[model samples]
Target: MAKIWAKAPSPCIGVCKFRDEGRCLGCQMTKPEKKRFKRLKGKAERRPFFLMLRERLEARDRWNYWSRMYRRRCLKKGADCPLDKLEGAEREARAA
Candidate 1:
C-alpha cells in the first residue's frame, strides 16, 4: 500500500496565469516550478518547495493573499497545511 500523504498538495490554487516575470500571481511559481512540484513525491521533497515558494511570495508582498488562499485549499482538500507549522515570529512576520 502507498503511504498516505498528510501534507498539503501543490501550491496552485487553480490560478495559472503567469505574471510578475513568469511567476504565477496565485502561487508565485513559474511554469518550470510547477512541473518540478508535480515530480516531488513526498513531504520531505515538497516541504522545501513550499518554503521556497513562501519566500518568493514574501518578496513580492503576495503572502497575504496566497497564504489565505492556500490555507483554504488545504482545508478543502482535507490535507495538512504546511503554513500551520510556522513558528513564533516567523509566522507573525509573514502574516503581515
Candidate 2:
C-alpha cells in the first residue's frame, strides 16, 4: 500500500524531457535523479536534500538560470516526483 506520504508532489506540469536519456531539459537533473529513482533507501534521510535543492531554486536571483533550471528538474516525471518520493517521510516528520 502507498504510505501516508509515500510520494511527493511533482514539480512537472506534463513536460517530460528525459524520455530519451537519463537527462531532462525541463527539470535538468543528473543521471542519478533520472534513473534508479525507485530504489531510494529511505524518505527520512532524503527529504532535507530535496528541500535544500528547493530552497536553492527559490534563492536564485536569475530569471532563467541553470541552477534554477534543474532545481525544478531533480526528477523526470510526476507521480514520480523525485523530491517528494525520495524525501516525503522526512518532510512530513520535519513539519511535525
Candidate 3:
C-alpha cells in the first residue's frame, strides 16, 4: 500500500522581490513553480518542487539562507522539516 503524506508548506519567507523575470529572490521559487506549489497536493507532488528549489538555491549560493528560513518556517507551522534531506543543512543548523 502506498503511504500518503501531507503537503509540505510553502517556502516563502515574505521577501517577495523578484531578482529576475521568473525567480523570486526570497524563496528562490520561480513564478510558475510558486503557482504550482500552491496547487500541489501531497508530499509525492512536492518532492520535485523542493528538489528544483534546492537546485536553484545552490545555483544562487543561497542554500544556507534558505535552509535557515525553512527551518524557522517548519518550527512555526509545527511541520516536520526536510532539513535532514538538505545536504549539510542539518549540520549547519546545529552549529548555529
Candidate 4:
C-alpha cells in the first residue's frame, strides 16, 4: 500500500513556513500555487500525477516569466536531467 501522505488528506500545513525562496519544502512547489500543489509527494508511476506537477509548475513559470525559471524536472522525482527539457518548458507554458 502507499504511504499516508500519498493518501492525500490534510497534509499541508498551508502556513507555508517551509518555503525556500518561492518553493515549498513540502512538495517544493512554487509560491504562486504552492497551495494548489498536492500535499502528498508524487506517485512512483509515470502518469497524470507527474504530468500535473509539470503542468502546474510550468503554469506558475509562465505567470512569472521575468524571474529565472531554471529547468529542473529531475528535482520533482529526485532523478537527473542533464538535458533540462523541463528547464525549457517555458515553451509549453506559451502554448498553453
Which model scores highest in lDDT? 1
Listed in order, each prediction's TM-score against the native is: 0.78, 0.36, 0.75, 0.26
Off by over 4 Å in 3: 1-5, 86-96
**Residue-wise C-alpha lDDT for candidate 2, range 26-86, written one tens digit per residue:** 4444457634444443455345545654554445432245333334554442334453343
Q: What C-alpha lDDT do the candidate models reach, one value each?
A: 0.77, 0.44, 0.72, 0.40
State model 2's lDDT.
0.44
How do the candidates rank by lDDT, highest first? 1, 3, 2, 4
**Tens digit of lDDT per residue, candidate 3, span 52-82?**
7888788889988988988898879877775
* Model 4 pairs whose backbones collide: 71-87
Candidate 4 lDDT tens digits, 1-96: 233224332222233454566665444456655444444353343223435555654555532321122223234445433223333554788888
Q: What is the Cα-based TM-score of model 2?
A: 0.36
Q: What global local distance difference test value does model 4 have?
A: 0.40
TM-score of 4: 0.26
After superposing candidate 1 on the true structure, give the runs of residues whose Cα lies further than 4 Å from its correct spot.
1-6, 88-96
lDDT of model 1 at position 3: 27
